[model samples]
Target chain A: MSLSGLNSLYREVILDHSEHPHHKKNLKQATSKVTLKNPTCGDVINLELNLVDGKIADIGFTGEGCTISQSSASMMTDVVLGKTTEDGLEMAQIFSEMVMGQKRSAADLKKLGDAAILSSVMQFPARIKCATLCWWALRKSLGENVDD
Target chain B: MDSKFLKIRNDFPILNQKINNERLVYLDNAATSQKPQAVIDEIVRYYQNDNANTHRSVHTLGERATEEYEAARGKVQRFINAKESREIIFTQGTTDSLNLVASTYGEENISAGDEIVVSYMEHHSNLIPWQQLALRKHAILKYIELTNDGRLDMDDAQKKITDKTKVVAIAHVSNVLGVTNDIKKMAQIAHIHNAVMVIDGAQAVPNQPVDVQALDADFYAFSGHKMLGPMGIGVLYGKNNLLNKMSPYQYGGEMINFVEKYQSTWADIPWKFEAGTQNVAGAIGLGKAIDYLTEIGMQNIANYEQKLVEYALPKLLNIPEITVYGPHSPKLHNGVISFNLKGLHPHDLATALDMDGVAVRAGHHCAQPLMKYLNVVATARASFYIYNTVDDVDQLIYAIQDAKEFFKV
Candidate 1:
């Protein structure tokens, strides 16, 4: 059986990000920190955001998860490192919607950077949570009301 | 390969289809088995003709429904060799059955400082109910450790069950480890300590012949879905005397004999435990599944599965990157195989396998405590059943190889 279908889900960039995750460390002094877990698979993300003047000055995460989750977390930290908290939350919303198979504009998608590649995760419905877990952590750390 | 077992795949229409442009090789039977056409037909036929509330109305349909439902209980009783049909209480599933026992029997028996013994290998359904019960009563909860090879450490079991131990609950087969615990021996140990033995037969009953009476278990619980039956239907078998003494699990219609102004009397052992409208179709479907299993013969099925494990386990172990969690020898292992590839998370492996039409389970498997004990976050599991064949095993090996290559692990 050909596994060509997997090419869309596990792209080279995602694998590379998983192998060498950016900003995967414990921030010593952080204004906000949240730990989110995907109880279904025991994946945990401890996200720390150092917000100064309502902007994310530094962001880091430490967790154990699959390649998708690790890569997603890496990409998330890279994109939202210096963005304002409001923009970070907006990016989280866009990532969540994109992975849920929702349509998003190119400008909104551009804000996500490499994380937008996970839109293919909509096909693998089961792994959608793995891809969005870090974004949820970002939202929760930012004190946003994440009902979903 | 047995010719009879070879032909068993024909009975499941769902197994005949293609998945992901490849021949579907279902290896997730430990989660839930594929229902045979006979079982499906039974449910449809029940809904078409004999759909009614069981043990309630006086109409002919009600009588037929009640008869079929009770007959299903009898099938379960005979299937597990329970002493009587009254000992078989129809439940929502294994989780519901376990909770029923923990609520009724456990609640009535356990007290402060009492101890409940469970193993690290228990599924959450079996472990959490007792754990919660112990917490509610301020009792102590103890665990039986596993041997280095992933088998239950019977020596630890002996050490754990003491005079303070009120209940010794364990799984008949480990869902992740693929090792069958010696329930009979464990029951003997529990009885010696005067503690009740609750056997979680959710994994065992579907794959092997179970004789609850021979095991002398106080309570035996199993789900129907894992045995080629419908979901939302399960069995909880308690000894007649124990069941007679325990309080009713739920209070509702059909469970009460008479309701006085302030109090009420309960029905018989089985019916008293079964409250509200029952799943008549599910029960009838379970009875059909039992009939199918009986025709195939439980011993034959067990032997066939052992053969499959013997054929599959060695090849699985041959992969240098793969680390199997259970016993390496097929003699000690069963159909359920949990493994992980070095540097490749199970979720990625499972996803890659799915692309090849190889369905597997990846996660903590609802056994977080066990996952902790194994020192891993999660692992991918491939379980076998009657319809799975040598070709399916070959497909699994091929898919694992493909996954490793895809992930470069």
Candidate 2:
């Protein structure tokens, strides 16, 4: 009856971010707006990226979903806002790998910013999609084909 | 009345399993009940011996298949006490059945400025079709609010259902709130307005014996899976006169009475609605499920589950900080209790219970409007059925207490 796997999926930081999300609104006059939804579970993500000189100038989002989805959106906005498009895409890739419980080192996830708290979600296989939904959309908004 | 059935704990094979290496205590009957061996055997027997396309071929097996399918229709008619067997149409499920009525019947009769009334407690399947139908036909969609105890506000229900209302569709029971609605009164109100009443019997038919004629409902919909049958089969029972007046939902080979170079006429009531090849095995399974229920007696099953709910509610309420939703008594509600442990998120609580081999649903139960009305993101639900016992509720309480201690919530 050990929920060691489940506790990691809903860590304290994730709950805190879900309760008080940063950059959770519509960005006024933002450059790019993209919407994605997990049709399976009805988790939605709306990403508005403000681009400045090919790097992320600002970012924001608003949607409804489970705690994994909401917190992941919060942490994803914090991570990709100030980074260049290439670096942002790279960070999204690493975060995706981390959530899937892939064998990626700390250095591999060092660039994911506050989203790294979700690294333990890899162990709980069912929640990987919830943790990576926002990161997947952010990468697509930045113009890379999000195959996963 | 048989001891084998009374002591039929071993009849359900799914109950003898382990999930994540823990014994399974299934509590999601409102979502879909676990099938017994008789239902499964009926499906297997159909595919093994009598598998044939119904109502088309002239061969011996085809005739038998067609007869069995039609007999199943009669079984359904008698199960719900519908006056005519032709009024029952096989559908994909409750969602598909409700959509069929909204799309085919509602499309033709409803027009601009007309109104369709539904309650806030309706499942998404019952709500969205009418909403879309209203939007498309330039009609208005009205909602019946709830009182503090989560029962439908009868005053609000009466006030909103007026002469302009063309259809009053509501659930016979709320899956999330566990409240059994007064469909007889609702049907009376709809008739007063010259509106058709559509009943969502998905939750009600499984838990109780329903008489559509007594309710005076124009249309009633229910699914097979929730009633201890196979999935992918549901029933839409309409008053024969109304069904005869309505148009066919889909067009295909089976539903046509006559086709010519220019014009064609659809088949009779139920066949006209069932356009394609129906789910034959699923129908047989549902028929077997109905037979099983008859053997145990629906009244007895309902009484047993009500007692279980009555027993469980007090134990759940005694938990110091837990917040139980819906009516506090089983007499005021169906056999369902949705609640939230003091500080534990529903998903977390469900996961914790899963570790202890207790299964419960932890979501909005497809009634997001009710969830929003309750002002919670999600709540854990434990629904009871005939197989559940007082000891099972005790095990559930112990498991919740264990989860509470482990999570310190």
Candidate 3:
């Protein structure tokens, strides 16, 4: 109970997003949809995005997973809605880099919106994949030039 | 903690350590048991004193190596009460042994319309090989359903196994559910249908006493590392008559009697199955592990674990919002418990528990069929062995509660 590492890893904000995830239903009329699975832990996400011209007009996700993954997906939908696909992919890179322990500038940190609290996920090496599941799906769905 | 387990755990050096500033509470026995110091020292002694290629030389070290290697086979033969040492083949692990049967015996016996029966509770290792075999031979694959309490339904089993059934493979104990199937009665049913019986004993051999003769299993397979032994060493117990007739799965050195340019004759029953260089040190270490367990007695180990489950299962059921899979009574199964905290995912729960220096497995447990049968995506598992104590279970319960509170479930 006194483990400070656990406290930061499961912060209040992250738990809130996980419990009450945003855009948690199926986007049946989506323009682009992609499914990703973490075969090791069986966490899966079906990411649906509505691209109007060059912007993500709407976003939603449906999946079953641990708190870190579900909440990460939830927070991602809130951050990427109404943003250009370019901005969404850029935000994903900044978010991935931040969680991977790369030094992020203040501007890049600000782009993550509410997901910046998940930077402590790096401390638990086993859970980094759980934290990055949605971002990968987004990058894949948008057909971005990801350096994965 | 039981008085017997206190001394039993002392044999393992890795258990007497700490992780993240807390004593390690290892409840991951179903994944793999910790190695005893005796098994470790035996592995080291082989390298230090008797290190040489076995069965192909006349030098002193070579002779010593061959003696110890085949002596290890004798130990395994005695461990499972096989008819002869030749009936026990050295395999890389349980998956390898089961695959050998599926490839060799299955290929020879299965016709285009033949049937292979497997239970719903089987691990992927036991399920996939026969699945591929059925696909390859154009045969039929049938499954026996599970009962409400997670045990195999005998009525369903009888109905599924029929005249077209040429083979039946089953898990001796479910890795996820912890229910021990009555393979003795199952073997009888398979025999009545003129079918062969194969038992996947990977989970059972580690916790209970298994006698293939008593079970009448045509082929029994298990991994050594699960039973306080080293990795890379396992045993396949096949009846000599059946093994003598089946074709070799893998063809290479040490497994053949004569190799012509076009044709080759096999060496013998077990050697024909074990190709290339085997895990000599691992086999010796596994033998030493058997010696360690034999000294403790497998029956005593089973009895003690049953008591541990009887003590722990009820308390776990008492937790709010906790959903446990498998039999409610401990006497009906071994010491494997799979449960879930309603709203929290197993991965998050396992990570939180790890922060408290507790280690348990969280996943589909390589038994997705059983997971589907139980109606869940995944679950958290806490499995016990001879080295585990009641105190470990207490800490696990406490850690689970902490996870529940942290997630505000």
Candidate 4:
């Protein structure tokens, strides 16, 4: 692989999302909260979910991480906002499988919306955890047993 | 410039490989050094011939293995200028050696309200053991501050190590910053307070000459893999009186003198600490690594690495986007250089550099407290070794420049 291969991992969309992340804040009224750390690299994510009637009414995150993690978190929060807890959990699972290079139908991946762009993360095994860290935080906050 | 050190790279076969269609420039020596063929051959030669349980069976192979293992101990003793081979104990790595000291010596010595002082720049292997020991004993764990340039604050060390201080543990060299601490003076301070000084030489032993007696360190720990030997083998050097007094780190067959149902007597100092069957092949491999380093000479290695740093550091600092941690002057810095780009995280920088086949370490480097102290989550570190050449340093700079262009930062 040449340096040009980095283009697949750090596309313009990913760079834009990382540079100007959405929902990068703390929610004043968080129903459930979880903080996860990628211990190997010291990357941390504090995810706040304001769940109203089993739906993610609002979602926010605050932490320090690399570009992939930050952009992945941005994309994750964009897709999961206003999503039902069940749908959010399923989406997290799909995202995990997607980054791990597992097969997903177009219809199943379409549910991820813009977050599907992260399917390329499979090529960079080292950064797979960085991409999934925020999703793990989302799963744990939505009452899933994420043993991260 | 074709230097003799550049010629030394031929001894390491791994350095000849290519990554990402570019020459592999290994700058992760702080994490682990690549083994030379001599050490590799020594390990293979041992497994082929002297594969037997040491200090047991009276067979020829067992005796040969035992002699080789003990001879490795003698090499380690001379390598660090230890007074006796009995003071050296084989361990898994620097972490295991440190844990041994904490579990045995710290368990016996530390009590409530005593002070255990360490520096802010210590790696986790050196820090957590002492921190947990203090926690277990209800002792106060104090941190000696670093200067603005990232050097260990000697005044703060002097102030922190009072009469109540029972143990003073510090790294002989910072893995991230590459600044050598004043171990001799620090040991003097600890001795004045009647505290035992433990030196973590994991990074130091591989980079420069270390004399435990001259530094007056009561206990010193270092890993073999970081010094070009195999993993799962390390050395813990301690004073004879201290080793005799400390309890056995573990209980098992080799460390036993005689066992009777429930009661058991322990073996001598070194063997008492080395519980089960040891890493005999790894020990012999480390002996070979010591021999290789001895041939080149530690002072010569140190001097050559210093020249590389002097050449590389100014060029690295010239990049406006880079923020280097540690002393800015080449005279004060060693080979380990940690830095971060202006708009790029270290992880991103490391990945970008890897694309150019320059392997650097990017993380907290197991020095999370130091990272926190530096107010950054992580940083990219490029460390040098004997086989590293000036061309490798140029590749590192070019990669950084390429990363900057690729990221448009």
Candidate 5:
């Protein structure tokens, strides 16, 4: 397989984030926490989000799963941190659409960085859920509509 | 064996397919075997011509379907050497079969303080039902330990089967370890303890010819798909007396003998356990599968698979990082070889092999306790069957080598 577009999916940046995820601890002082799991493959992620002024001030996750699931959560935290709640939700929608093989115009996916690697994952249908677990957890914490 | 049997490879259409542009090398027979054209054709014929509910109506289709269903039961009875056709009951599979016994027979007979003895190498199908049965009955569940080499410690098993033991359920062969248990001896032990011996023959019956009466087993369960038949058809064989004594698992049509406003009576031994309208096409397909196995001769299939296992074992062991679980000698193990490549996750290895046209099973093998005992998160298993040749083993070896080089693991 060509490494050009897919490299970012397993990039060292993502691997590093997965190996040592940031904010991967239980936050007793956090405003919202949600546990999300991909039941089909047993990939679980526990996300604790600190929401202040309707913005994600901090986010952390801890769980055991494949590299894709772990890295997806790490990348999610990087993209969502410092973004307004509305922007976070909007970004998740675009990411979800991208993973589902929907043709999202480049403008719809702004500054997603390595998150674009997941777009290639659309060709391989099985890994789509792994790429979307973190986003689903975030949407759940934000009280946004999320299925499973 | 039928030396005149048409090229067996031709019967399995999937075997001709190419994966990553290479011919598919299927070595996941223990998980589920590839179906032959005969079995598939029979299933299709059933749906196309003889699809109807069994034992219900006076219609010709219903009578033909019922005959096919009962004929499949007879095949199971003869295959396992059960004393009578009444001893055989069709189930969903081995899992459902075990659950049937645990739910109906266990619920009826077992009481609090009773003990159930099982082995550590059991599949989850064999393990979880007893665990649930123990919980429901307030009984104790005990496991017989394995030796360092994964063989059942018969001494430990003997010690575990005590006077209070009501059930001794064990697997005929470990799906993960591939170690064949001395089920006959175990049945004798159960008899000594006055406990009902239930054998999970999911792994064994597919490979070996079984005689339940010779083994003196009280209950035996196996699935059809693993034996190259259609899915949704499984056999649960129990002694007629025991089956008659037990309650029906599900209350539904076809299993009833009579019904009144305030009273109801269940049908005879096997039908009582088969409450609902069973999988008609699946049973017919399974009957055809049994005929296929018999025509090829079980002894020949077993011998051929044993040779393949023998050829594969040493070649697999020669790999530096490869760690093969189960018996070192093929004689001690079934046709399965569960192994792990050092530093390569099973899923990654399996995916890599998929690219090379080598299909393997990469997971817990539905035996978590065995996985825990193996001290690994998961394993990649390559299981062989009669259709598999030395070339398939070579392909698996080549694929593992490629994976090692590709992943540098």
Candidate 6:
């Protein structure tokens, strides 16, 4: 066959983020620290957020998983860094919807930042759980149920 | 063996198809084996000729269904060398069969402070039911550790199974490690301790010849889908004496012989456990599958798989940056191998292999405790069967090399 589909899923940017993840250090003091794991695939994400004055001043994650899951966690931290807690939650919801084959407006898609590139991930049904694990961690740290 | 075992691959039409423009090298046999045309045809014939609820109706189709269903039970009994056909109880799959034993036999034998012994390598189906059973009955759950070579530690097993151990459940073969357990020795130990020995034979019955009476196991459970049969049909082979003493797992119409206002009598040893309407078509297909396996000869199938593992294991180990789990040779590990490439994750490696039309299982293989024991999160596994050839292993090696180059590892 062709490497086209595999290459699309494992984009260069995604690989770079997976290789050199941003804000992947442990936080000593944080507003909330939530650890979530994809029991199906064993992908784990320990997400810590500095929710200062209702805004996500800093966000970091530490875990081991596939490139898609790790890069998704990296990009999630990048997009939700300076956003409000509510906006971060909304961005996670939008990213989840986009990966689930939802058609989001460009304006709404912009809210997800680098996570929008995972739109091709919808074709790989098995990897969808990997892509959304970090987002589930984000929702959990914000006092929401992790399971959908 | 002759080329007949190889020619049997042609009987499975799905094996002739292509994936991603390449010939599909289906290697995930431990997860589920491909069904031959005979089994598929039997399922269709059941739907077309005999489609009726069994055991309750007097119609012609119902009689045919009941006959076919019981015939399938007899097939399973003969397949495993069980003394009585009534020892075979049909259920959903291996998981359901295991749960039946745990809920019924476990509830009757195990009391508070009693111990249930299982190994570290059990799949969740075999592990969780006992774990839940222990939790409910306030019993203790003990583990039989693995040896340094990844085989079951028989000395530890001897130590763990004591008078307090009311049940000893273990896998006949490791789904992840592919190492065969010493079930005969384990059963002897359980007998010395007066505990029932339950063998999770899901991975074993498909690849090797299993004689339950020879093994002296009290209960042997396996799934039909893993052995070229249709899904949703599984067999639970229990000793007649123990089955008579145990209670029924479910309360339903068919499993009852006589029902009063508040009391009920179970149908029989096997039927008492098989509650509700059973999967008649699945049972018929499983019987056909057993016929196919019998025609191939289980000894020949075992030898073919042994040759495949002998050819593949050394080649797999020769590859740099590849770490294979379980025993190094075919002497113990059999046809399954779990390994990890140096830099690539198993999920990504599996996807890359899929691009080459190679199907493999890339996860914990439903043994998270074993995953933790192996000190890795997950690994890619490619299991072989009678239909798989050495060429499939070469394809797997090439896929691993391609992944290493692609990921720049």
Best DockQ among the predictions, by candidate number: 1
Model 5 — TM-score against the truth?
0.90
lDDT of 2 at A109: 75
Q: Whose lDDT is greatest here? A: 4
Write candidate 5's Cα lDDT for A1-148 as tens digits. 2112334345566657656776667777788878887644445788898889988888888875665677777778887887788888888889999989888888777656667666766765756777889889988888886777
True contacts kept of 2: 0.17
Per-prediction CA RMSD (Å):
1.0, 3.1, 1.6, 1.2, 3.2, 1.5
Clashing pairs in 1: none
lDDT of 3: 0.90
For model 1, residues B173-211, the per-residue Cα lDDT tens digits are 999999999999999999999999998999999999999
Consecutive 10-residue window with the lowest summed lDDT within model 4 chain B: B1-10
Give the TM-scores of the predictions, in the order they appear. 0.99, 0.90, 0.97, 0.99, 0.90, 0.97
In model 1, which runs have C-alpha deviations exceeding 4 angstroms? none
TM-score (chain A only) for the predictions, listed in order:
0.97, 0.91, 0.94, 0.97, 0.86, 0.95
Candidate with better TM-score, 4 vs 5? 4
**Candidate 5 chain A — worst ten consecutive residues by lDDT sum?**
A1-10
Across B1-409, the per-residue lDDT of candidate 4 in tens digits comes to 3377879889999999998889999999999999999999999999998899999979999999999999999999999999999999999999999999999999999999999999999999999999999988999999999999999999889899999999999999999998999999999999999999999999999989999999999999999998899999999999999999988989988998999997999999899999898999999999999999998899998999999999999999999999999999999999999999999999999999999999999999999999989999999999999988889999999999999999999
* Per-model CA lDDT versus the true structure: 0.93, 0.86, 0.90, 0.94, 0.84, 0.90
Better of 5 and 6 by DockQ: 6
CAPRI class of candidate 3: medium
Looking at model 6, residue B166 earns an lDDT score of: 93
Residue B68, model 1, lDDT: 86
Model 2 segments beyond 4 Å from truth?
Answer: A2-67, A70-81, A101-107, A113-119, A140-148, B1-6
In model 5, the clashing pairs are A23-A60
Off by over 4 Å in 4: none
What C-alpha root-mean-square deviation, in Å, does candidate 1 show against the real structure?
A: 1.0
How far is A30's C-alpha from truth in model 6 (Å)?
0.6
lDDT tens per residue, model 3, B1-409: 3576778778889989887777899999999999988899999999999999888879999999999999999999888888799999999999999999999999989999999999999999999999999999999999999989999999998999999999999999999998999999999999999999999999999888889999998999999999999998988999999999999888889899999999989998888988898899999999999998888899999999998898889889999789889999888968899999888889888888888889999999998878888889999999999988888888888888887777778
lDDT of 1 by residue, A30-52 (tens): 99889888899999999998999
Model 6 interface CAPRI class: medium
